[model samples]
Target: MLPWIQLATAKVPGGGELRLMRRGEEFSIRLDANELMNSRLGGSEEALATLACQKLAGRPRPRVLVGGLGMGFTLRAALKVFGTDATIEVAELVPEVIDWGRGEMAGLYGDSLTDPRVSILQRDVGELIRAGAGRYDAILLDVDNGPEGLSRPANDQLYDSRGLSDARAALRGGGVLAVWSSGPDDSFTKRLRRSDFVVNEVPVRAVGKRTGSRHWIWLAVKT
Candidate 1:
């Protein structure tokens, strides 16, 4: 077995640092000692896009906003489902993660970043959500471990009451807000309902199969 090699490090906005690591062909993004995401475990991330894209499949020229660019899995999955007429806006707070996708992990990202339908924003996704009104056909958030903050404290706002309301307002009618979580949060589901979204909690595997740990994806459609 090969030892993990540290590729690069980046500072998180609110606090803490992110370390990108590579072991053989596998890549991982870590916060302190905890692994945030891995190249191999992209099942739920892909599901995040697939489930949301399924909702917008009939729309002509769908506009989507992805809250995180973790290894570009979500973006790539979305690009696969969306046609050339679709537009995808990826907002990643950590710039180095974007760099990793284009640099060390370029093979993992492939041409997804260069795809004409995709746009990269090196800023907080929350800011983008707050700044827009009925702007997107769907919003996919995989920023933190769950509704609770893990890497950055400020990320908590993205799942809070006001934040969810802002996200609701940012979407076009019937737009879906799909969120990835390490586990389930009953309160978050309740909050989603209170914000006038039709919420669905889906249990997905970490690697798409039934082998790994179960993760959750919250599909909240604006009502």
Candidate 2:
């Protein structure tokens, strides 16, 4: 078995400490005792961000809120899609994850955090959603493993009925809420529909190129 070491850092929401655990060569971000993100097999993080940006088309100054910085793939993808006038607010719970990207994962991120349009928030996605007050044109969520909540127990709330409702209220009219899941989630689709979002399920290849494991994205638009 690969050894895992807990990293020391700042405190997190719900009153606890943040840490990073290493399993073999891979790393995972954790809030207190809950795992927030695992880098080894989590490609949906990047996929959701890329697909959301792609769906935005040619919007000149789109405002987007991304939940979970992870490896910075989502933020980097958003930068590619939107121009200088655009603004991106990234809400990440753990500060260590941000540090990791600023340090170890610098090559992958390449100063996307330093982009003038990007704002990093060391806060919960739920708080950001509730506080948005229908300001964002797009909300890209890549926080959980799906509706199943594999990474953390608290994340389950983010995929539940109330959470979906909050997400709907957070978006402007006609805005899109893009969620990245590891696999298919029919119940989540039903939940989205019940929340008054016109839901679209999209399948994307893991690699940006053609041919790879199929991942799913749920794009729910406020109507």
Candidate 3:
């Protein structure tokens, strides 16, 4: 068996640590001791984007904001659905992850970073939402666990009432806010509705097969 190699490491904003490991061609992101994200047979990012786009049909030349760039799967999927003139701003707090994607995982992403349509911001998504008011046509958040913080405590703020409010405020009129989660979040759906968003919960198969692990995506449209 090939030995697992430590590709890179970074300290989380809130005392925890995140580490990336590579075993041959596969990579995984671990928070503390447990695996937080895996780039293997865990699930399908394409399916997630398909569900979100279906919920956001008829929007053209949309300005998109992606909260996280995990493995560049969601970003690639979004680019496929949006037009060439569309802009996608992806905010990732960990700089090392970006560096790793550029150097080690470049083959997986295929120059997505260099794409003119994408603007990579090395900042917190919460701060970005707070500063960007009524700007984006769509905001796709695939940060840490669904409505639960695992890697960073600050992530909890993104799911809270104030954070959801800020996210809604950042979207243009009738814009969609698509949130990816590992599982269903009932209370979070309620909070999204309370924020005045037309909400829909979508369930996607983990591997895009007929039967697999289930993941949830919440599509909330700003009214």
lDDT of every predicted structure (CA atoms): 0.91, 0.78, 0.83
Best by lDDT: 1
lDDT of 3 by residue, 1-223 (tens): 9998897888877758888889998888888788776776445456555566666675787888988887888888888887697899999998888887898888878978999999999999889899999998888888888798777778989999999999989999888888888888889999998899899888877675666677888889887
TM-score to true structure, per model: 0.98, 0.82, 0.94
Ranking by lDDT: 1, 3, 2
lDDT of 2 by residue, 95-172 (tens): 777888887656657879899999999988888898877888889988756778655678878888999988888887
When summed lDDT is taken over every stretch of 10 residues in candidate 3, the lowest stretch is 41-50
User: TM-score: which candidate is best?
Assistant: 1
Residues 27-141, model 1: lDDT tens digits: 9989999999999999989999999988765788899999999888889899888777899999998888889889999998999999989899998899999999999999999
Candidate numbers sorted by TM-score from highest down: 1, 3, 2
- Candidate 2 Cα deviation (angstroms), residue 70: 0.5
Q: How many residue pairs clash in each candidate?
A: 0, 0, 0
